[model samples]
Target: MRSRPKEPRVPPDRRETVRHEIVSLLTGESMTAREISGQVGIGEKEVLEHLGHIRTALRSRLVVTPPACLECGFSFRKRERLGKPGRCPVCRSERIVDPSYTID
Candidate 1:
């Protein structure tokens, strides 16, 4: 039987660049951390870490789209920093699209 080839490991710097690109794409629309991870070909936790750096780079330029609850239509406006919300205050729905951004 033929063995599958191993995928090349992405360098840390390249991973950061990928994260930056993903953040740029995410500026127009909100996306989950999982989605960003998939796009960047990295782990969700890694994506979150990248987000922290991206947020710092963006600083006051950060533009959060505000996550809306799919079930209850609850919009998260003045909640806190970026990350998955525990639950919707209105209907307690876990489904949410956290805001992300990039430098213009």
Candidate 2:
């Protein structure tokens, strides 16, 4: 029988540190949720949840650079708080870059 590898344990403080780093990365440039998830080694859905808490901690000073439509110049403001939109409402473009939110 083969043994499975043990999962790495991350402390709460370390997790918070990682979260803070994520916010810092978003301060200037926008990053996709998938990218963030990959960097943080967590699920994309979890990144959204973490963002909610991070926003509240930052007192709504979170700068969100949501994905914009290239054809119609439509921004995903309505669906800005969470993950990236599947398609653009105005142009129906499926190409969406992940939004980045930072706490200032």
TM-score of candidate 2 to 2 decimals: 0.66
List model 1 lDDT by residue over 29-57, tens digit each. Answer: 66677777877778877777777777777
Q: How far is candidate 1 from the true structure (C-alpha RMSD, Å)?
A: 4.4
TM-score of 1: 0.63
Give the poorly placed runs of model 2, Cα more than 4 Å off: 1-21, 24-30
Clashing pairs in 1: none
Looking at model 2, residue 68 earns an lDDT score of 76
* Clash count in backbone of candidate 2: 0
- What do the candidate models score in CA lDDT, each in turn? 0.71, 0.74
Give per-residue CA lDDT, model 2, range 1-104, as digits (tens).
99999999875456457667778767766677788888777788988898888887888777677777776778877674577778887778887666765555
